[model samples]
Target: MIIMPQLSPIDVLKRSNAAWLIRDQWRNILEDAYELVFAGINPYTQDKKAPRSMNRQFDSTATASTVRLANRILNEMTPPFDNWADIKAGALLEMTMDKEQIAALDQQLSGVSKLVNILVNSPTAVSARSAAILDTLISGMGVILGIENPEDDVVPITDQAVSQSEVAIEVNARGEIGGIYRKRKIKVREIKDIWPDAVIPSDLLAKLNEKKDPEIEVLEVTYEGGPGSNVAWYYEVLMCAKGQDPHRMVERTYDVSPWTVFRWMVIPGMPYGPGPVLLGLADIRTANKVVEMILQQAAIAMAGMYLVRDDGVLNPDNIRIAAGGMIPVQYTGGNGGASMVPLGTNREFDLGQLILDQLRTAIKKHLYDGTLPPETGSPRSATEWIQRIKDLNQDLGVGIGMMMADVVQYVRRRVEVLIKRGMVPKISVDQLTTKVEINSPLARAQKLSKVQDVINWLQMANAAAPNAVATVANLEKIVAWISSMMGVPPELLYSEEEKKKIQQNIAAITAAQAQQANAPAPSQAS
Candidate 1:
């Protein structure tokens, strides 16, 4: 119930612009991430007064690693049409629903999940997500603003990628991003189209009447609802004309925030998190500089240098270092002007090459794009394999866990939007009624290690004492849980009642067989 301070449009606008200034403190670091890792992305502050160039990368190692890792995250976390997630009943609601009802719910939710996946995998979404993930890798965080397409019934969601440079975020006390303020230049003519209710200033309208489509700055903000508000966030579009106070163009609220700020790694109490680029920025910069130096060295080596003694024998201006070129020089000491001695130029780059190799390796390590060398020792044992999986899980678990949170939010928010637009059936979706299950490749891998641990424990219990495993674990429920986690279809599983009926029938048959066998022996003796 935290209440936002009441502020006039001018104050809000000034605050939004001030956030940009506050964020500029990280300009150097963010600029390095942009210049070294992704030259195409906007830096923290750009020189609007001058033309810009991109892709000035001297060393491609970090750039290559960044692109590869982004692709890896996309394919593994939100692979297209992979059925990587599901919507199901939450713990509180599961006990209330019967098996048939739960099954029906699953069927309904599956269709909704499918539609959501469609929206997420759309061309616009993929492109936006790809850019966002790349920026997250390079600049620590990325954002995408979801916009609905009212025309298309099948895939009604389109995404617009927001550059980190233009966006400033604030986190709530819960360590979640509660507000986003973004500023960008927009053309005068497009204001009516973008914000139909905008009240254009007299001076700007006067300029527009003169057919001058001047571009002006506009600030867009989405923030948490104040006390006693119902919606998740309030949205407003503001503008500050030249020499005038800022004013609001559009004001509205949303059930879920359209703009999402996703970070690679969070630092508590900080709105923005650090990315892999920050970890390897030093190596990236040093490696690029080293490679630049190597190129310079090579150029110098190719353009041979020589010293001509003050004897004026060899004319320095007449020397041609190219193929088979000769320069006439006065003879001295009976040695055809051997006085023109070539200066010592050592072309061996062993040291530079070694440094570059190590730098590249470090870059890949930081980006999680490195390869392990061949195994020269004994083969890995079962215990070692289990440990290996567990280690990987521990290493990647935090980031992947955070990603899962975003993915769930993304799905739920998009689904809610769909429901609001009548693209989906009318159904109440709240945290208490349903839950999201992530089955993406990396998420499942994280779960796989835990599943293995449970199985290993069960095996140890069985080895220690017969029937002791049953006391420690519900073997049947474990099977069902494992199957669900492993992507097994629910229809293939047996219900508890069906299992009990089968067990009873088996017991009856066994008793009859025992009675028949015992009676047969007595009859044969008679």
Candidate 2:
């Protein structure tokens, strides 16, 4: 009676109860479920197991018919086809065939639809398909659940648009948010009145204003320049504050004057042997003896000049040079006659050599005659030695010419004044005589008239003294003057005391010799 035109399996299934059971008409609904089941089967065997049960409460004949129909549907449908059971069951229910078959088909369609729904909605099933489809669906939800692959063109959440009502934010170049300011700027009225004025107590301020003057006063002394002498040596002296007048301070200059008698010891000739013959002789031993004597005299003179007792007046004792000299000069004949010479006095080289020779002879005599100690003996103190040399020079006619004796006496008087003033010590006159003997430049020249040599010798001697005032150029003048005066080397002389001592010693020696000579002839009584 109701003959349904030959319906395609899928079309029949769609109109059946199975299609009503499915919630959504997925594009490949039944086809996808059938493919899943078919793919799950082993291709090596044609006999594949069914995913669902075939036996049901349909008519035995209908069941066979339904199975035959399923087989025919499978044969007719292509790769993408509906589930065979679903199609068969849907057909049976729609045709209202036997009640029992309808009931059974309805129950089968329900189970088949439930299975399709599970497979379609499951995450596991979704993942089983291509991932591109799932990603597209998730991206459409508007929330980025995870990081996109670097190669993808997906924009990040940060790039999304924001509204004006949202908080304004700033990202530093480092990609971090900038924070709030913590410091504020202020304005100043003036810079000049920044510091507060310092307050001073009345008592402290009064003390600062008080004046206290020092008692010491400085004195100035100006010497009138001499007519032909453009040069003058200047010096100073100190006085007690008591009974001192500030106006009289200028007069103190007269108290300090240049020393009149400038003296130095003569180390005559060179020492024995090949070294520089300072004293002129080739024998080093003899020369050394001479040098030692000269040094002794020089030392003594220095001591007397500074340390000897003198009157209260400053005198020559107050005068002192900066330091003793050890400087030398070489002689090369020139317009000036000689390159190297003493700084003061007019003595020539030949006279200097003669004086040195005489000094050497005198020193030798003392050494050989045993009148003085050997060179190695304890030398007389510098002061004693100089005094003695001066004494010897005066007595021996070696110092101060007859005409210059007054000048020498004037210098000695000044030295005496210094002694009386306690400015110099009370040294033995004998010692002073010895120092004068050796150090007197005039005496040196008197003993040797070789003006050039004398000049050289004096220059050398001045250079040897500490703080020598004479200049070599001036020494040349002094030498020239001495030469013009027709001075000759003086003979050795003695003082009365020394003469007495010499006479006594000679007498004793003579008496001994006479006794020896007058002794009875060796007894030859035969």
Candidate 3:
């Protein structure tokens, strides 16, 4: 291996601009998503204000529902401080490694998951990730990007959720992410600290001295490159200021991409996916409008709207109807010539109520609002509870699958950086092929039924014929199944190779006991 040269940063900037133009196709929808579901934090602007339509979402059902679902989604996908994913040894690795390497490999595999957790559980990671998950729900795409942070000894990983507005991605026909381009506004003073390669002008320093802290933009792009055998991800950074040519900052290449892109759904040939919020945006708007109308109706009934004759002295604009306010009216003719007549507040509320309720229910269900069953309802049996969790997970099956897939790639990408940084022991290519099994709360719930099923089967088998139990049940598989269901941390459990060693020990002990039992007592006979 000879390492190939990376593209110049200027080229990176040009390609990124082209991709961003494509992302603009999603600009309007992304704006709508942030308004309705993500609390209007527009990363596109430094002020981060929501768009004006934020007020239009008066019903709040979509916003509330989005938040509730995002939390649940996070807990299920990658709960903070919990072992949400497990790294399992692939079959090839297990069959190849002998007893001596078994314990070492197991220990190595265990540490990988624990260390990855520490990196992800960092304050910044969770804070940003929470937003990214919401972005996934609201805009259909969310991003977890690993950038240089100098303040840390561990993986200088950012936990800040990158706004959709800051990111543009190119996806291939096979649903693989081909490129990721992100732009950020940074204060001139801090640029030197973040990117060691950054150069600051004396003029910029003078501005910083004046406490100006003028903002400069940086465009970072990571794109797939290399011919078939030499395939790799390339990275670049460039200074991107309006009305100026992109100045190259730095460039590099990596075996794995630093970007972890999450999409709610994958539509073939589409560069991005749209989440449930976009699907229900119409309903959300409609519901909000209906509620606002209903409130207006109530206001009209309480503080009656009135019409006055076109009288010379009434001056309708001056009319003030407070608790005890006074209004002067001139009487000039019949009915005082300034008499105010009531404008009818009378209107039907039933139809609006119906539409609103229906929209709310649909929105809540779409967002997985986690509405609990009535506490007054009959208590559920253990079996019923297990089944319920299974049903819920099944309903979330597709989204969960997509999220977990992204997570697997994310973990592997993290491993690439971690190994180079010596944060974790280096795992070979075969080891990297290991499975990333999700073990989140929802996963545990879905697996609980399997555990129950195994237990019930074992109990029935032992009751029907105790002697046949050993043949009917694989003790190792049974225990492993139970452990998975219990959501045991990978660090605390034995790997497949280690379990094989344990089974061998058990078999040896059993064989010895049987041999002793069969052996005759020759000394006693003599």
Candidate 4:
């Protein structure tokens, strides 16, 4: 038996294209042929005795006639080609051969006939071929018409595919790119990696089980960065819920960008069920409007928290205003004509305490009165309240001088103890006197007798023994003893050369006193 070779896929594809073209030609020919066959004059005249009826039967007859004519034309237009080989050869030649050349056409006629037969013999093959050809032709026509083929409208499909493909491609590219791009690197840096230091650790849920009312809530928030690049970290306290995600209460992180961190914190009824909450946000100078909004929200929330009723209004009696003024006092004593004595201890203390109490009362009154300014009355306003407090503080400073006098007295007692303990030397007495004269105005204003009395006290305390040894060794011992008592290093009292001169002066003074005491006895014998 002779073996029949299987057709290649390319051969099948070509045949499909040819069949599709043939079918299209048939369709066009049939349409034209049917139009011609259906042509007819109206049978009923306008003057017909009975009114002419446009019935469904007449429409059916016309359609049947048209179909029959279409069949005949299609059959004639698409006659069977001979075989697969002939059809294939004809198609190839048709693509390249000039249709205007009679010689080439004559040469290919036999092959063309065989191809037509093959197409006609296999209906299934013919149908598949026709479908493929129709698809291609339709697609081409669509491009020309600027309208895509309904079955193969692949523009949107291709675009979608491309987008998905691009996403994949970018991901892969990023992996292969090694170091991050500068833009991405900067963004990553800006997003600080606080993952290691996150306030809410992974194990927080377990620890949260041990608390009552363990609902986690954020409290204070702060932000850092420049005007446009700020970021925030939120501080929160979590309470245990009766039955919730976490049991033990603790702290958690609420990292956010600076732009709305404050809003997040101060938002009423936020982390917990809606109610008044205190939230401290960063003082953002650039975000003035946002800051104002936050302040208003906070004020409203505070008002709500302290509200006496549900009417969303603060109580008028809650408002208070405290005010005060200062008066400097001078006293005339029996001995002195007049002296500035800022109403000493008793009066100063009493006045200060009274002023502070009054201020507190004013605050209480303002809060109770609910007289906030702009919204309420002048006295209740924050501005007015602040000014009132400021004035009170200023007045309180008047008595501060008397308070300082008590501090000075304590310091003087400590100094006197140090002097008696020989922690300060006698030669330094002149220096000490000068210091007292310069610093103690009260001492300077004392009677001359009182000043002399103080000097006498000093002289008795600091007096040295008569006829004391004045040799270099004795002087050195004295200087060293004084230096030790004063907590000053001996070397600092006198350099090696200066020590010699100090010793000589002490020896001369001692010798002069001895000679005078010895010589005065001989003169008294006469």
With a 3 Å backbone cut-off (N, CA, C), the pairs that clash in candidate 1 are: none
> What C-alpha lDDT do the candidate models reach, one value each?
0.74, 0.29, 0.72, 0.27
Which is the better candidate, 2 or 3, if ranked by lDDT? 3
Each candidate's number of clashing pairs is 0, 97, 4, 44
TM-score of each: 0.81, 0.15, 0.81, 0.13
Give the top-scoring candidate (lDDT).
Answer: 1
Instruction: Judging by lDDT, tell me the better candidate of 1 and 3.
Output: 1
Model 3, C-alpha of 292: deviation from truth (Å): 0.8
The sequence of per-residue lDDT tens digits that candidate 2 reaches over residues 40-117 is 321212234443332111112211222332232112210112221111233323455774554454344344333332
TM-score of model 3 vs. true structure: 0.81
State the lDDT at 260 in candidate 1: 65
Per-residue lDDT of model 1, residues 1-526, tens digit only? 5555545687677667666666777778888778776565455445644434654568989889889878878877877657776777676678898866886687677777777777887788888888888878887878899876556676677788888888988777777777789888988889877666678668657864575667888888888775566666888888766786677777877777888677878776566667888878899989988888787677657765565554554465776653223344344334545665555565787788899999999999888775432336889765555455455445555665676578777777788778877867865556568877777766676666778888888888888986777777888879877887776756687765778899999999999999898784444654
Where is model 3 more than 4 Å wrong at Cα?
A: 1-5, 38-46, 49-54, 98-104, 148-151, 154-156, 199-212, 227-231, 314-337, 370-385, 429-435, 446-449, 456-470, 484-526
Model 4 ranges with Cα > 4 A deviation: 1-492, 505-526
- Candidate 2 stretches with Cα past 4 Å from truth are 1-421, 425-447, 450-502, 515-526
Q: Give the winner by TM-score: 2 or 4.
A: 2
Worst 10 residues of 4 by lDDT: 159-168
Model 2 per-residue lDDT at 19: 23
lDDT of candidate 2? 0.29
Using lDDT as the measure, name the better of candidate 2 and candidate 4. Answer: 2
TM-score of 1: 0.81
Tell me the tens digit of each residue's lDDT in model 4 across 401-498: 22222223222222332333443332221222211111122112222234345445445544653333232125445445444332342235555457
